[model samples]
Target: MEINEVQKWIKSYYGQRGWTDYGPFIRVGFLMEETGEVARAVRSYEIGRDRPDESTPPPEQLKNDLIEEIGDVLGNIALLADLYGITLEEAFTAHKEKLVKRFNS
Candidate 1:
């Protein structure tokens, strides 16, 4: 699904479950934790890289872990946007517009 669709789905799901008070600090903490996980995954990947002679668990595993971390980050971002009453479509559009303006300049 698109980012906007995912955001709407998340907002609706949480809203229905009565999770309306998403604080910025909480989201920040979540992001930090997720970032740590991503770092750990990267470290693991590096360790695997250094052990090419040994039986490696395959690069796909590390890639999957990284993808999971990205998903976690996206989840926290969606929560943050929901807390601020900002839709994903609006955020994406605004950011794209800014990038276009910067590039044109």
Candidate 2:
């Protein structure tokens, strides 16, 4: 459940399936696609979609979809980081330090 564990699992899961041949740019594309899904999930949560042709999912289903999409985004980010030999924990550490400097100054 740690970031390193998750990164290792992502690498193993994809690597076992032979899905680890992506270039950094291609990984970025996958990350972007997952990000768009997250955005759409957020939009659904904030405002119900207008689609009379299809019935809207219940609130619970929408929430689940949002969580899944967010997980997808996280997985993509972890994979991209692993591709570059950086761990998410290290990224978060640097991120927090930057925020602290920017705000506490």
Each candidate's clash count: 0, 0
Question: lDDT tens digits, residues 1-105, model 2?
Answer: 888998899889988987778888998999999999999988888797778886788999999999999998888898889888899999999999999999999
**Cα misplacement distance, residue 103 of candidate 1 (Å):** 2.2
**TM-scores for all predictions:** 0.73, 0.95
All-Cα superposition RMSD per candidate: 3.7, 0.9
Candidate 1: how many backbone clashes?
0
- As for candidate 1, its clashing pairs are none
The Cα local distance difference test for each model comes to 0.80, 0.90
In terms of lDDT, the best-performing candidate is: 2
Deviation from native of the Cα of residue 96 in model 2, angstroms? 0.3
Off by over 4 Å in 1: 12-22, 46-56
Judging by TM-score against the true structure, name the best candidate: 2
